[model samples]
Target: MEKSAVYHRPSDNFAYSINKTTLQIRLRTKKADVQNVKLLFGDPYIWENNEWQIEEMPMTLSGSDDVFDYWQVYVSPAFKRLRYGFKLQSDADTLIYTEKGFYETAPLDTDFYFCIPYLHQNEVFDAPDWVKNTVWYQIFPERFANGDSSLDPKDTKPWGSEKPAVNNFFGGDFAGIIQHLDYLVDLGINGIYFTPVFKAYSNHKYDTIDYMEIDPQFGDKETLKRLIAECHSRGIKVMLDAVFNHSGYYFPPFQDVLEKGEQSPYKEWFHPHSFPLTGGERPNYDAFGFVESMPKLNTANPEVKDYLLTVGKYWIEEFNIDGWRLDVANEIDHQFWREFRQEVRSIKSDLYILGEIWHDSMAWLRGDQFDGVMNYPFTTNIKNLLAKQSITGQEFIENMSKVYHNYPKNVFEVTFNLVGSHDTPRILTECEDDEQRTKLIYTILLTFMGTPCLYYGDEIGMSGGADPGCRECMKWNEEDQNLDMKQHIQRLINLRTNERLLANDGEIEFLLPDSPNGIFGYRKYTEDKSIVVLVNSTDTEKSYSFTEPLSDIKDIYSGKTYTGSSVTLEGYGFAILNY
Candidate 1:
């Protein structure tokens, strides 16, 4: 037995409350090392005589990555408390794993077991139920459309006439979005995540000049209210970006600090290192990156917290916005987010709070702060496998297994999954303009777990590089759009909507490949029904055989029935099978 590889903890993903009465426990061991595991658990105070009374339940092998095999078991303690240990058996050895260390036999003392003192219902990781079912469409307002050209900014170019630049604008507004509500509805998008519609100087609107007012370039508050109402009427949820991490250079508080230096009442609102603030090279004060235009706000300040908290509540209270996507969320203090979650959720208990964090965000997703984070790790793995072709199918599955085990099931389900966004290159560009590869990427995205987000122009096969290049004006002309790609996406969305297994309905099991570059897939299943999603990442035809006979199998995507246990797919092909 590889004792060093065995691991477990009594908190976070390792152990957690799935609901008010049920507690889920997990154990990890080296891959293919342990033959079996039995969880020994009981109420800490249920002892009768001298021997601590406990019940043993066999742990099921939930999943296995490259290095570790994860085991899980669910229990509901009668006393709402638990003290647990594990008995792991390998081919040649059997060991009792406990809190103190490895023991030759199960210990009688409850001190030797890991503890969950009590299971509180509030501790269960509860995110808004609506988020899991949502398919998000991210709209960069400046590039989406221009319904009311009267609101165009000075020097606004004709829509789609030229390439996009950092400073260029095409006068996209709420009225424009309102005009295209039917287009989004037809695409099967139930949630719209608008990037920064608040008053800001930049076309991107990440730098907030005023938290309370809508950017005139986007439209007046009435236009935004109408937009939100239209979206709600169509059963679409609206999530506005909240750039509370920093303020634009023109933001009144930042301007006051820059002008007054020492005497400014808002000096403490920002992190100015010294008097006489300057914005050259590296700024004298802390800023977002080294960009002098965006100054990071000191959210720890009481007044600043109050102002931002108001901004958080004002939109939901007045306009009934469904969600807030926090910008630079990881850089801010946790206490502020905890308070922000409490403050915003108090108004709308089901309000979704998503954070823009690109790394492992377990710290912020403990049911106290963010309901979910921007799933950049997922984006990276998908891009590497499909777009870059740097990683093989087996490598992709192994890497993603680690990602799946990182968070609780509930938290993972609501994560914001995206392939392309305003900050990254368009998906078609990432796949080097190959429509087949781009379609494959969308197949994995829309069919994968969690809430998936599509960039504004990706569905129509728009091609562009990162940043300014990705923010091109939406092509409204039917001749200019890729109807095939758009239809492919629409079909995937329809499948996701009609089929519960495609969403977060059941347990997922990734079918590990036999070779490095072999075909890969995952099975999402309940007790009786199952859906298997297979992908052939290669450029040639490939065949995959089922371990057991699959009967009554139907290819949901193609509406074709299969008779055999094996299936064949063409290059860059995918299959959504229902059995």
Candidate 2:
């Protein structure tokens, strides 16, 4: 046995309480190394006559990646406490594992076992339950719509008349969003995640000039409140984007530094490499990448921390916003985020806190910092397989397996899954204008675990590249829109909201077929029913044979009933089969 490859922890993703009583535990071993694993667990205090009451339960192989196979088991301790260990039997050796280390023999002492002294309900990773059931719509405030022409920027141009540029604005405002509430409601989206709407000089609003005020072009504080109220009246939730990692060059504190240099009282508010502030080809201090206009905030400073925390509290307490989508969240300090969570949750305990992190985020998702991060890895992997066709079905499963086991079940449920965003190319364009391929990807996204978000105009078959190109004006004219694509996405949204098995709580299992080319499949199942999603990502038609008898199969998309064991799909085809 390759014992060195084995890994487990008593807390976090490896083990966590799914509810008040039920605890889920996971173990990782080298791929194809262990033949079997049995969990040995019992309450630490449950001892009688100098013997601890223990029970042994076999663990099932849940998933695998390139290097590891993950095993999982669920346990509910009668006494609300747990002391557990694992017994592994491999082809070459047998061993016992615990919190301390691997042991040659099973130790009778409870101290040697992994411990969950008592499962405190408060420590549980509790994000809002509503978030898991939501379908989010991400709106770039500057490009969504223009309701009030009076609020248009001085240089505002005609909407959709020209391609987007770095310094151009199309007069999209809060009134525009308010004007389109019915449209969004018709599309069946319950949550709206708006990119930074605060006062900023740039069109995207990432560089924050004032965190307290909404951008003039986007409307004032009152306008935002009205928008939020309107959304709430229709059962929709509002989440505003916050950029606290840095301040724009025109921000008061940053401007003070530039004007008075070291003499300014707010000198410590930012990071300055030298006595005099300098901004040229590169910043003399820390900033967001190479942009000197956005000076990095000194979050460690007490004053700066207090100011940011106030900003975090203001939206939830004053405006009654549902959540905050933090920009460049990975760049901020852990302590600041912990305090931010405490302050914000103090007002609204159920408010969702999502981070804009593009990579591995296990550190920020331990039930303390963030409810979940933007699931960019999910986006990348899906793009590689479905859009680019660079990976096989088995490889996609392996990649997803790694992500599946990276966090506790609660965190995974709230993950922000998206195929395209303000930062990426449109989904249809990524699929080379192939509507079938785009629909297939959306099917997987909508049916998979986590909350799914759709970029504005994606449902109408809008196509563009990244950045300036992706931020196109919303096409409201039916003549300019693709009605078929819009209807397809609307149907998906309805299915996701109305179906119980499609919700975040469903158990998902990826089916790895023997054939590696063009086909990928998985099933979202519960004790009462199951839904299988299969997709063929190639140009040519494909055939798949079921490993077991699939009885009473009905495709939700096509309403085609199948009683056979095998099925065939047309080019770039897919199916959502219910059994």
Candidate 3:
């Protein structure tokens, strides 16, 4: 037995309250090392004599990655607390694993077991339920459309007439978005995540000049309210970007600090290292990555916190927005986010709070701060697997399994999953303009767990590199768009909307292949039904045989019926099977 590989903890993803009464505990062991595991658990106080009474529940092998096999079991303690340990059996030896150390036999003292101090209902990760069913469409407002050319900024070019640049503007407004609400509806998008729409100096609007006012380039507050009403009327949800991390140089408060230095009442709102602030190769004061124009706000300040909290609540209270995607969320203090979540959610109990974090965000997702992060790890793995072709199918499955096990099931369900975004290269560009590979990427995205988001022009096969290149004007002409790609994504969204299992409804078990580059897939199943999604990343045709015989199997994508244990797919092909 590999004693070093056996691991468990009594908090976070390992042991967490799934609901008011149920506690789900998980254990990890080296891959293929352990033959079986049984969870020995009981209330800490439930003891008849001095023996410490307990019950044994066999832990099921939930999933496995490259290095570890994860096992899980759900138990409800009568006393709302638990003391648990594991009895792990390998081919050669059996050992009892607990908080203390490996023991030859189960220990009677509860002190040796891991403890879940108490299971409070509030501790259960609770995100907006509507998020799971949503399919998000991200829009860079300046490039989406030019509905009213009258609202165009000075020197605004004709829509899609030229390439995009950091300073260029094409006058995309709420009127433009409102004009195309039906287009998104046809694509089966239920949620729209617009990049910063607040008044700012830059075209991207990340540097907030005014949090309370809508950028004139995007139209007035009434126009935004009308857009929200139109979206809600059509069964769509609106999520606005909140750039509270920093303020633009042109912002009134920031300009005052730059002018007054120490005498400015708002000087403490920012992080100024010394008097006489100057901007050059590096700013004299702390800023967002030494950029003089974008100054990081000191969120720890009471006045700054109050102002931001008001900005957070004003949108929900006034415009009835459904969500807020926090910018630079990881850099901010956790206490502010806790208060942000409380303040915003108090007004709208179901308002979704998403954070823009590109890495592991377990620290911010403990039911106290963010409901979910941007899920950049999932994006990196997918891009490497299908787009870059740097990783094989087996490696992709293993990598994704690690991402899946990093967070609680509920947190993963509502994560903001995306492939191409305003910050990354477009999916088609990432796949080197190959429509087939792009289609496969969308297949994995829309069919996988969590709410998937499609970048503004991705469905129509728009291709561009990172940053300014990715923020092109939306193609309005059907002749200019890739109809096939659009149809393919539209169908996938339909399947996701109609089928509950596809959208975080059941447990997912990844199917690992023998060879590193071989065919691979995952099975999302419940007690009554199952869905097996297979992907063939190679150029030649590939076949995958199911371990168990499948009867009355139907391909959800093609609507073809077949009864068999094996299935074949062409190069870059995917199958969504239902039986």
Best by lDDT: 1
Q: TM-scores of all models? A: 0.99, 0.97, 0.98
Tens digits of per-residue lDDT, candidate 1, 1-579, equal 999999999988889888888887889999999999999988877768777898999998878878999988889899789999999999899899999999979999999999999888878888999999999999999999999998999999999889999999889998889999999999999999999998999999998899999999988998888999999999999999999889999999888888898999999999999989999989999999989999999999999999999999999999999999999999899999999999999999999999999888999989999999999999999999989999999888888888988888778899999999999999899999999999999999999899999999899999999889999999999999999999999999999999989999988888877677778999999999899999999999888888787676889999877777788889999889997
Candidate 2 per-residue lDDT over residues 1-579, each given as its tens digit: 888999999888999989888899999999999999999998888789999888899998888887999999999998888999999999888899988888887889999999888988888889999999999999999999999999999978998889988898899999998999999999999999999999999999989999998899988999999999999999999999999999898999999988998899999999999968888788788899979999999999999999999999998988999999998999999999999999999999999999999988999998889999999889988999878989877888889989989988778999999999998889889999988888888888888899999999999999998888899999999998999988988888888788867767667787765577756788788888888888887778887788786677889878898777777888878888888
List model 3 lDDT by residue over 428-515, tens digit each.
9999898998999899999999989999989999989989999999999999999999999999999999998988998889988657
Which regions of candidate 3 fall more than 4 Å away from where they truly are?
A: none
Which candidate order results from sorting by TM-score in descending order? 1, 3, 2
Clashing pairs in 2: none
Q: Which consecutive 10 residues in model 3 have the weakest lDDT in total? A: 559-568
Show where candidate 1 strays beyond 4 Å.
none
lDDT of each: 0.92, 0.90, 0.91
Tell me which of candidates 1 and 2 scores higher on lDDT.
1
Q: For candidate 2, give the lDDT of residue 42.
A: 89
User: What lDDT is reached at residue 240 by model 1?
Assistant: 92
Q: What is the lDDT of candidate 1?
A: 0.92
Question: Candidate 1: deviation at residue 157, Å?
Answer: 0.7
